[model samples]
Target: MTSTKTMLTLAVATAAIVAAAPAAAQVSGIATAAPDSAILSAKAFGAANTQIATTYKAQLDQATAKQTALTTQIRTILDTNKDGQISQEEYQASQVATNPLSGRVKAAETAGQPAIDQLRAPAVKAQAYAIEQVALKYDAALQAVVRAKNVNIVLSPNAIQYAPPTVDITKDVIAELDRQTPSVPIAAPANWQPSQDTVTLLQQYRQAVYMQEMRRAQGAQAGPAPAAGTTPPATAPRAPTGR
Candidate 1:
């Protein structure tokens, strides 16, 4: 089951939207904050999202249609008997040489994947460009939020088993990020590339978005959906600490 922290964190923290840096502050009391959430919530992220969405609307639209068709095609193979769900036997069979349908199923998957990827590439790139921009400003935002909130000990939503609502300063952190960068450039040069950290952050952001979707859909995730290009991070920024 998803905890309130994870749910709440994931709700706003899509794309880690990534996480903030390890907090450096005086310690006085304990508080919980999801820096990942804050990073996603920044105004710049929103602005970038709008810009990217506008720029890549056609690609996104194509992707949406392609994804739906792919889902149907894949579902037919996985749910061979139309049982409404894919059984382990069916899934395993689809991958092995034993089933005659295996070759066809594999073929379908291989053929459709590239087409879908190509269609979504432009939008995906734009999304990444925007998210990386937000990540660049995350450290400063974390510090500002921690100090302004007078939080001494800050923990990730993932770390806290339980905490009072008041201690969850994810919103304040986001507000700080907004103040830091109201907007960022959405376009990336052909030579442009994100750092490994930004790449990881983008992944986390996607995972969080997936989790959030599962919660919303009751355990069913759709596709490579966008969540403010979520601040995905393999190593999210740490929250500030108070003495």
Candidate 2:
């Protein structure tokens, strides 16, 4: 599991590497692709995702609603201060039997989790199937990109320290994949299954999507930026920067 998680971190990063060989004073023939990114970024994957979102809206909504309600219930039980919020101290207290309402708090979580999982199963399966379909074309699309670009060597970004955007062929591979398979079935057939590796890739993709959503939400909550050249509302002063 640790190895899988490590792989997920690497796989989610876009890959690029410098060229090993150069002709005279000029350098060329280097390209890179994060196969996982290529597959996930393909138009087909995004299109299929829209379909999955539509198909599983009810289930996903139920899971989200249940989760939100569970959080409120826990806070209501544990917020003995009646501060209308659960602090770290209160939250920790709820986990142990010492708190008078710990049992009810724990029970709510225990009962809510399985129901939420059941609600989420369909969307998760559909997403996995879509990822598998796009992943199937990765090797071919990569090879095609290599041949067209006359790439000498390609490497994963995780395997190296840094690379320039010009050498990263991820977008090219994504375009190739879009051409090869414009879309795939969002529904998995009975008895259909993905490999363990594809399952891990699905997990990684979900984590990435979750993070993006969080950043977006945070940005929205931050409100619009101050107008250019105008004095902004004051916050804490920062330390001076170095050259």
Find the candidate with the highest TM-score and give its number: 2
Give candidate 1 misplaced runs (Cα > 4 Å).
Answer: 1-29, 82-98, 159-163, 210-243
TM-score each candidate: 0.65, 0.72
Query: Residue 21 of candidate 2: its Cα lDDT?
Result: 28
Clashing pairs in 2: 15-157
Candidate 1: what lDDT?
0.60
User: Across residues 9-124, which tens digit of lDDT does each residue of candidate 2 receive?
Assistant: 55444232122324431236655567778888899999988898788888877777776677566667777798765566766666576756777866776776677666777777
What root-mean-square deviation over C-alphas does model 2 reach?
11.9
What lDDT tens digits, residue by residue, belong to model 1 across residues 1-243?
A: 223234345544431322343333212355666655666778887788777778877876776676657656766766767766656666666666776666766677577656766666666666677877787776677677777766555566565445568867778778777877889887878877665555655566666665665466444643322211122121121111111
Instruction: Give model 2's clash tally.
Output: 1
TM-score result, candidate 2: 0.72
